[model samples]
Target: MSLHSMGLELVETVIYLTNTLICVILAVLVTDAWFRGDHKGSLLYWMIAAWVMFAADVLFASRPLLSPVVARILPTLLVTVGQAILLIGARVNSGQTKVTLVEPIGAVVLHAVLLTVFHFLAPESPLRRVSNGLIWATLAYLSYRGLRQSPPVFWRSYTAPAKAFMAHAIFHLVRTVLVLLPLSSTSEALNTFVAILGDLEVSFFMVALFVGLLLAHLKQRNEQLSSALAEVKTLSGLLPICAWCKKVRDDDGYWQQVDHYFRNHSKIRFSHGMCTDCADDFRKEAEKLQPSDL
Candidate 1:
């Protein structure tokens, strides 16, 4: 091979390695959060998706070791499924009405099957590229939808995930249009350009995913800390209490029952119960009580 071609190959490999590292690092970060816990274990899906994308990168790099068919199809399969999994995580985290898991899963499977069929028929066709690009754009759109439509506590409208999704969607759409254009004279150049652009996309996607998801987790964690602080602040200071009535004074300067005070200030709720001393005293009182007193 010419030195120029060799240099390009080296650069491509480096980009793939960089993308792989991003996926692995993201997988580890999300795994920590997943184990620590989030609402509905949503981070579990994110962790899995990160690892899946990592696997895709590994598989693509190991193409020489894989059967031609597997090498061609598996990486794409992983990419599509990873996107679906992210959407699922957002849906789970948001506690939104679910889109039956089968729908998304089935769409991915069917797409994979179609790709496989096309691979056997005319793998190099522009139609395949167009189809692939559109599906990727669609999945990215759905992922954005999942995030934007999530419950207020889970995600804000203006967030990294939203931007990531929009970027991916637009990138794929532009790529599709470029491929669809009948530029016969530039076909070879177009192919080379597309290959380089695709490698860059891989790098950008991994970084975007890592940063976006990391920011998302951090945002959630900050919200939680803020909430805890708010609760603590509410009950922090010395409160004026009625020693005789046992009522606590609230910020409004109105006396309220202890249960009401705690409930309003924090998550605490009262289930009325008697302690051992109180129970014993009550029993004694009952024993000493006459029928008229009762």
Candidate 2:
């Protein structure tokens, strides 16, 4: 191969290997999320998205074995559908959306139909490239928006993922614009450079995104545990109770009724009723006190 051809082959090899590695990492993350038993749906969808993108890379790399139409359309279709699903997953994780089978299933069907129409009706047209890019860009934008709008308690944790999604969206938008540019050797070279840069950005941000998600979930859980501990500590230590009154002394050295103490320290509620023994004792004491003592 010529020097130029060899350089291109090296770049393609690197992209392929990187994508394969990402797919493996994503699979492992998904498994970890499943074992953790939190955010499984979101993690599973993210994993599926990664697998779809990896499959697209595989298909594109094997273009030599495919017919012209299949080679032209299949990879792009996979990528479009993958991005849409990724957005849905991100939204669900951010609590801005809910998981449903219909959206992802519909996205797959829509991508396939669009690619089929583009292949037969307008082969090699900029419309096909533009449409694909636009769809991916839109989904990325939506994901960014959802992450940004996460609840305040979770907003800090989601910051990194939101920024990553924003970066991803920007890259796709740039790609869409590049697709609409006039074709020339110079433009093609620039487009190729942009495509490789976009891929690298995606790889970096995906790693950050998943790690951020895991950290955010752990942080939320930690906060919950801390709150529970604080509550438990409130009722701990030496609580002084009056020998005769049965009232408990609080941290401030103020005596409070037993029912009030428990209600303040915990979620316990009291029913105002004397026990049978206490009721009997009260009755006997009343009988002994009699009206004659007055």
Candidate 3:
């Protein structure tokens, strides 16, 4: 291999290494959140999609030793499925009701068929040029839709994820251009520079991801602190109580259910199923309902 190729290889290796580190950190956070049920607040499949893309990057970067067919096919399949899932997640999270699965799957399958044909019929040519275009086109379209129709909470509380999605789409678009553009012999310096710049882009993605997670963590912590502060109270003696109902009257002067009043006046939430009497009443009511409805 020439020095330029060697340099490219080294740079690619470093880029993949950085992605691997990011994957590890993301995996840890994802795993913990998944187990603890904290990620229930967000789209689980979208996070999985990011991990799949990370896997694809690792696979593609190892193409020198691994079979070229496997490298190409693996990333292509992953990028397709991952991006599709991510798009779906973004739509759902943003409260869009209409999403058709067939379009993305069909596009991916068609591209795979074309790529497989080209790999066998014209092995000398790189087919990723066309594949990248399709993927990026989809990404751009979805990113636009997501940004345009995003929820208020998505914009206010968790804006980073939205921005990350858009930024990712933009990067994929740039990748499409890089893959599609022809390289000239006279542009060797430019090619080298672009290669290094591409490596830097990967670094930028990692840093962005790290910053996103940090923001998420801080946002969560701030919310918790706010809640704690909101619930803190300085109570005085001889609080007003309802004479007949035995319910406490708060400073707001509203008569409330014992549990409801406590929950409103304090920080805790109620748990457990209905009591025996309530359960019995519910069963009797159910029995009285129409058989078809039941």
Per model, how many backbone clashes are there? 0, 0, 0
Query: Clash pairs of candidate 1?
Result: none
Expressed as tens digits, the lDDT of each residue in 159-206 for candidate 2 is 566666676677778877776666622465776675677667656766
Q: Local distance difference test, per candidate?
A: 0.79, 0.72, 0.63
Question: Lowest-scoring 10 consecutive residues by lDDT in candidate 1?
Answer: 150-159
**lDDT of model number 1:** 0.79
Q: What is the lDDT of residue 213 in candidate 3?
A: 42
lDDT of 2 at 225: 90
lDDT of 3 at 198: 53
> Whose TM-score is greatest here?
1
Ranking by TM-score: 1, 2, 3
Query: Model 1, residue 238: what's the lDDT?
Result: 93
lDDT of 3: 0.63
Tens digit per residue, CA lDDT, model 1, 1-294: 988668766776777777888788878887877777643457778888889899988887777678989987888888888888877876776567655577468759877987898889988778877877888888778777777765453345444776777788899999988887879236766866876897789778767765677677777788889999999888888999998999988888899999998988899989998899999999998999999996
Task: Tell me the lDDT of model 3 at 185.
Answer: 28
